[model samples]
Target chain A: MKGNEAIAEAAINAGCLYYFGYPITPQTEISEYMAKRMPKVGGLCLQAESEIAAVNMLLGASASGTRAMTSSSSPGISLKSEGISYLVGSDLPAVVVNVQRGGPGLGGIQPSQADYYQATKAYGHGDMHLIVLAPSTVQEMATLTGEAFDLADIYRTPVIILADGAIGQMMEPVDFSERKPRELPEKTWATCGHRGARKHNIVNSLLMEPEELERSIRDRFERYRKIEENEVMCEKYMTDDADIVVVAFGIAARIAKTAAQIARSRGVKAGVLRPITLWPFPNKEISALADTAKAFLSVELSMGQMVTDVKLACECRRPVDFFGRTGGVIPAPADVAEKLCAMSRELSI
Target chain B: MVGSSKRIIIVAGHFGTGKTNVSVSLALASASRGSVIIDLDTVNPYFRAADSVPELRAAGVRTIIPEYSNTNVDIPTLPPEIASVFFSDETAIFDVGGDDGAAALGVYERDISRVGYEMLYVINMYRLLIADPEDAVAVMREIEGYSRLRFTGIVNNSNLGAETTRETVAASVSYAECVSKLTGLPVVFTSVIGDARAPEGVENVFVMDDHTKKLF
Candidate 1:
């Protein structure tokens, strides 16, 4: 199954109905697929005029207490920055998909992992963070689509499934999760209108009062802290005896896995640290590796988005080195392995 | 409008994707049970699928489109929030607007998951570069690329405008198969001009496709 199709199917199966979007390359299949499939299943699939409108629609659906989502490429998501901020401000539950392409502008259509900064460091206006999930395979696309909805509803914060165009359009065998009937948590905060057994509900992001807004921001940050405590996800490969830890995410991490594997074969003592959840950053796990792992080698599609976070987490216990391919150029496994070996030798010397 | 027991249907598509014709016919098909169409397209400027307003209403198919909507201005105001009402109330036929991809997404994408949304993309192989399997996949990718919302199914609405024929309907089936193969999306239904009335099991499209298929 193509990754985009898997995401669409997962959204529907996870009980997603309202879909709003604009057309851009590498991420259009999800909307195109929904436009046709929603009607039969009794769902709402609309193509909006801009990324702004689409994000607003997702906001509306979430406000009304429905499971909703939108998808876009780098530039488009940048257009949706305000909406993402608003969703975070309001603390609404929804899903967003980014089939990343090369950018800084309307860059080329080839695959690139450039949106790491925008996704992880609160891409929108003001202080906020969205739950960002980085998926590697078509199977993960399907798997994460469902997980995003669950996390969004549970935390009342937007969840993002960040993938590049290649992952989205690429065809691969994937297992579609059975569409289980969703039992949404009680919504005292939802606006389904006042009714029997359901009380009046208000869902808004306007915290105009200075103290009130500060309190709201504080509360939201606290929730993020709790999420980091409970939901930080990462994968480690052959780190037990390794002297250097390679940290990466999304497609970059996948390549790192191969590179680390190759370097290990040649006895360079390289291992991979892949963060499935880009946001929580898995600080504690990396700290544990600080003693054994002589240095941290952070690789990203962008020049230095994740590296800064890695350095912050590792706290200078060991020196951190960086190697990246920007504007969507993906470094091959051999290149990564070679870099890993070189960096390992440099740190040792 | 029917109840929780009644089947709920959504007839949605991008602008100029013939959603009006599709929704009306589907409502007519199930007229025996009470049905209604809720118009949710707030993006287009002049042409909307809204004019069929009275027909669906007159046929006992309730239409819930916002009054004064036109294809000319940017009226982002949607009819007062009635989604929860719709959920608690009756069986409905949701008539969504055509392709202002971004504009059409207003106020509806976030809550559908909790309230429940089975989203489908309206595909007109006639839309530029949308007919080819790879192109169709590309178009879907483009939408996903911009909005960050993935599509779940394909609506094969291939017609040569008003020149639509039975053969064209078959061609649409083939186009749908191509999409299913390339993108792993299924063609849930197909639309053709009203007069050509396709065979049983072939979901009929409400729009008049013969002339526009060539023009568009």
Candidate 2:
């Protein structure tokens, strides 16, 4: 099945009760799947008028303690940022999927990782970080979608599943039956009806006090720090005795894995570090590998967005080079292998 | 004999009915005859004829994509190279978009009718909007009205993805018959994924392993 459709099914299997979305390329299949199945499962799937309205609907649903989600591509996701920030401030747990396509504006409808900075650094105008889960495979797209919901509830923060168009549109064998329902914490603070024993729960993000807002923001940051320490997810391929490491995520990681294998076969000891969580950033793994690896190469579909993060993660101790294709162009495995071979030459020199 | 005699074969259907897959399959099937596939699809960029150019080219089938197909430009410009497909004697396959994509095909309506093209409306009975035969006929009429071409045949690609079985394909025979009856078209073939059993009483089944599909 297509990755977007698999994600929608997995979301339904994970007990998502509401799905509000606006149609956008690469991610429309998710909404289409949800529209067909959500009603059959006694859930609500509404295609909002726009991305802004979709995310706000997700906000309303999440505030009432319902598992809700919204999906869009790069341009649409930008429109939904205000609702995302509001959800973060209100501490509402919801899943927002960004099946990324190219862009600064209304860019082309092709797979791209150009939104890494926008997604990890500033999804909205705020001092906040979302739990960004990047999946490379269609199977991971389904499993991580389920995981996105669990993490969103556990951390009480908005979780973003950052998938590119390649992973969103590709067909692969996915077993939706293998999904296990995650145990969730009770939503005692939810704005469900107040049974007359407690004060009516106000699920608004409008705290007008300076000190109170500062304290609350600090408290949220503390949770973010804990999440960074405990919830960083990544995968390593042949990094143990390597002279070179290639850092990537999502579709680029899939290509980089092949490139690393090709480099290894060609007698260069290369490895791959795939960051599953982008906001938590997989810094410790890269830092530890930087000690042994002679250099690091960051491969992406964007013009060196994640490479900046790789540099910071390695603390500039190791030389970090970048190879990328921007504006909907995907980097080829052979091209990445060529870049890695050049990096090896530079290391020996 | 169905697609062999026809010089220009146009594949169209609702979105997600596997028209691109069928187009690629047809081009590769006729690769020895030097087939050329055009990416006439402008509806969605994710799943289209141009995305599989590398694989199609490797199979010895030439692919002509629209201008800025995979590039970072939203301009759905049809390059002048499209006229080459009409003039060439080699087999041509046009992987068109859904009902909305028919409007793009409207541009070539005069040439298509003059040369007499075959429009294969691929159908998956499990897909939405066209799950019922009456609804399927209605959609075909809508597509015909939009594209200004009548469907020559139907490809009943009734699949539920990985869960598709012999029974699934077998069960869609009546649905295919219903659609054929309403549209006054013949069932060209129903596509089966693997070496699974073909429909019990149906003929002309197209067996596709989908080898062009890859992980990366």
Candidate 3:
């Protein structure tokens, strides 16, 4: 299954019923794939008029305590901001996908990972926390999509699947399993139409009072703190004797894996630090590795967004070098290997 | 895949591939008049059908996308409006960015599943990694990691040039067959551009035009 199509099927298996979305580049297959299958499996699939409508539709469905999701790339996710804010403010469980691309705007069609900050900080307004999952391969797509929904329901917060075009466009072996649907805690506030047993519930982000909003913010952060404790994810490869280390996530991490292999072949004791979860970044893991590794290198699709975090993880124990390919250009494994080797030699590690 | 209440639809694949094009074709094909196309290709600057939002609007097909269609734009976290549209007569298409789509949209399934909906996974074997079943599975897992949604079906959108002959269709048919064997999700349809006839063995044929809304 393709990544997007796989997500649709995974959602269905995960017990999703209704799907709403608007089409855009890089992510059209998600809707296209759903259009064909949802009806057959007794599910509802609709293409909303706009991203706003799709996201708002998610709000409606989630407000009623249904598992719903919307997906898009960098720019499309931008349009979904207000809706996401409402989801966050209202504490609704939903999923958003960002198959990142290059540049600030309409940069290029090729895959680039420049949306790190957007997914983590600038997605929507106000102080809201989201669970972001970064996958390095198609297998992770299936497992993480399923996990994201489970976490969303358990935590009552939005979960994000952070991937790049290469991962979505790329293919690998995957198997779909019927996951045990999460037993969501009753949302006493969901707007299920105020019928017989249901009370009229409102889901919105319009907290006018500073104190009230502040309290909500504090609560949200408290939830975030628990999430950080419970859900920080990463993949560490051969760092025990590593003199030079590479920190990357998603597709970049995959490339780093290959780079580590090649770097070792060239006699450089290089390793990789792959973060599966972009949010609640696995700083603890990196900081622990800093104790053993000589230095760290950050590779990304951008100049240095996640690198800042990697540096923070090192905490000046060792210098953190940076390397990347921007403007929709993918970083080759060989390039990463070469860069790591050169960096190791330069640092005389 | 557990007992989830919401069914989700995810659109993901490589760039320069036809996930977007096929998404539009699939939405238009399965949709019965009043369907909407939600464009989420905020990653790519050009080549998004949202450029002509008025066209889909005039055609009675509504659209929802990111705040802007620029490259440097931020990817927003929005709601999946399934409840209102699910029971309504309108059909919807969510056009997500290729790889970017998998990450962001993967989280909302728990919410939508509670409402009752099925999800679809679309594939274009012509794209990288997805050309093989193993690669396809890998991509699937990555998407699963985020959306928390289970995929129920597959849509084959494979073609070479504008003149996608039977060969292109046949190759994809074989690919979809293998994927079906691996993932247990049937390929429901094969999409074509213009009046390109449906490939002989395909279940459904989705036709799209140049002016039709494209995601990537």
Candidate 4:
């Protein structure tokens, strides 16, 4: 299946019973898949009028304590930002799949990672970060999508599956053999018809009072801190005893992995650090690698969105060079390898 | 030389049916003497057949693409060189574009019908519009009407991309049978990714690799 369709199937397998989405390129297959399969599976799949409506529908479903999701490309995601913020503020658990395309606005529907900042640092208007998972392959698109639901429910927050157009459009073998345990905590705070025994579970974002909102912000940050401690996921290849490391995520990491292999064959000690979870950003792991590696190369499909995160992760302790192809252009493996070679030569490693 | 006698093979279908991948594989598979791949697709600029020009060129397959393909600019300018696919003696494969893209092949329609050609309609029963067998037949008919060429056969390339299993391939067999019955055309072969086993009694199968996948 296409990466987009695989995500929908994985969502179904993960017990996500509700899907509300609008049509957008690259990620349209996800909504299309849901529209076809959800009804047969006894689930509700709705093609909302707009991206905002779709995200708001997801928020409503989440408030009702149902596993729900919404997917869109870059521009459409931007339209859902207000709803996402409201959902997060109301402490709703939902999954938002952003099959990223080129953009600052209305950008072309080709693969791009420019939304890294939007996905990780600022998904909405507030001092909040989404639990962002970037899938490098179609299999991961399934696995991470399933995992995103579990993480969202566990953290009681919106989790974002930050996949680019390449991973969402490309095909590879995927097995949904691994399933997240469904023994999740009951939604005690869910607004789903609270009986006469208890007060109505008000799912609202308005804390009006300054002190109250401050305390709520602290509580949310505390949860984020706990998630940071427990849920930072990443993959490291040939990083041990390597002089140079490549920091990437999603499709960029796939190419970087190939570049690392080619560099190793040519006797360049290169490694790759692919951050599976983009929000936690694998700060400590890359920081630890900085102790041994002489230099780092941040390769991305955008103009160095994640490189800033990489530098911050490593605390600026090492020389970090940026290699990127923007406006939906994917960097070739050979080109990435050549850039790494040039970096190695510059550092005399 | 799978279809050696047929000079031109027009691979057409709805979008994302692995037509480009099939075209590339066909060119590579039938390149015993030499093969020419003409990229007549202008609908989707992202995953066009021309993107594999370097790979096909390396494998001794000549690819004739439009003037501005695989570039940031998506202009549907057809160069005169496209006629070479018809003129040359080399076995030619035409990766026809999807939906409205079939109209792009209308220029060569009269020539192609006159010279004789095999038009294969690739169908992925999993895709949105073509999920129903009736819808699949309708899509093929729509393309045939737009391209002014009749479909000689149906290529059951139903897949769920990477999540495709032997079951996924087999499930499409019944769908393909229905489509074949409706269209009065034979199911030429079922295209499976990698070595996923073909359905029972469907001996003719096309094993497709993920050559069109941009990354691993």
- Writing each residue's lDDT as its tens digit, candidate 3 over A1-349 gives 4566667777777767778878865666678767767897788889988888988998888888877888877777888988888889988898877776665766655577888988877778887768889988676887888888899888889899888776776545456763455566776777766557655566777789999989988988998999999899988898889988899988888888888999999999998888888888898999999889988999998877898888887787889889998887677889889998888788887
**Whole-model Cα lDDT of every candidate shown, in order:** 0.72, 0.87, 0.73, 0.86
Quote the lDDT for A31 in model 2. 87
Interface DockQ per candidate: 0.02, 0.33, 0.05, 0.30
Task: List pairs with backbone clashes in candidate 4.
Answer: A1-B160, A1-B161, A1-B162, A172-B162
Q: What are the runs in model 2 whose C-alpha is more than 4 Å off? A: A194-197, B1-8, B14-17, B25-38, B51-65, B76-92, B99-118, B123-152, B156-187, B190-216
Runs in model 4 lying further than 4 Å from the true structure: A194-197, B4-8, B13-17, B25-44, B54-69, B72-117, B123-151, B156-184, B189-216
Native-referenced Cα lDDT, model 4? 0.86
DockQ of 1: 0.02
Error of 4 at A201 (Å): 2.0
Residue range A223-322, candidate 1, lDDT tens digits: 9988899889898988888888999887777788888889889778888888889987889899999878888899887777788888988898888888
By lDDT, the best candidate is 2
Over B1-216, each residue of candidate 2 has an lDDT whose tens digit, in order, gives 335688999999887788888888889889988999988888776667787888889999988898777566645677788888878887889999876778888899988888878889999887655888987888888899889888898989887776788998898899999999888898888887777756666788887756434435
RMSD in angstroms, candidate 4? 4.6
Per-residue error (Å), model 3, residue B43: 18
Residues B81-155, model 4: lDDT tens digits: 878777778878999887658988888987897778988889988775688888787778889788888899888
Q: Model 3 compared with the native: what TM-score?
A: 0.64
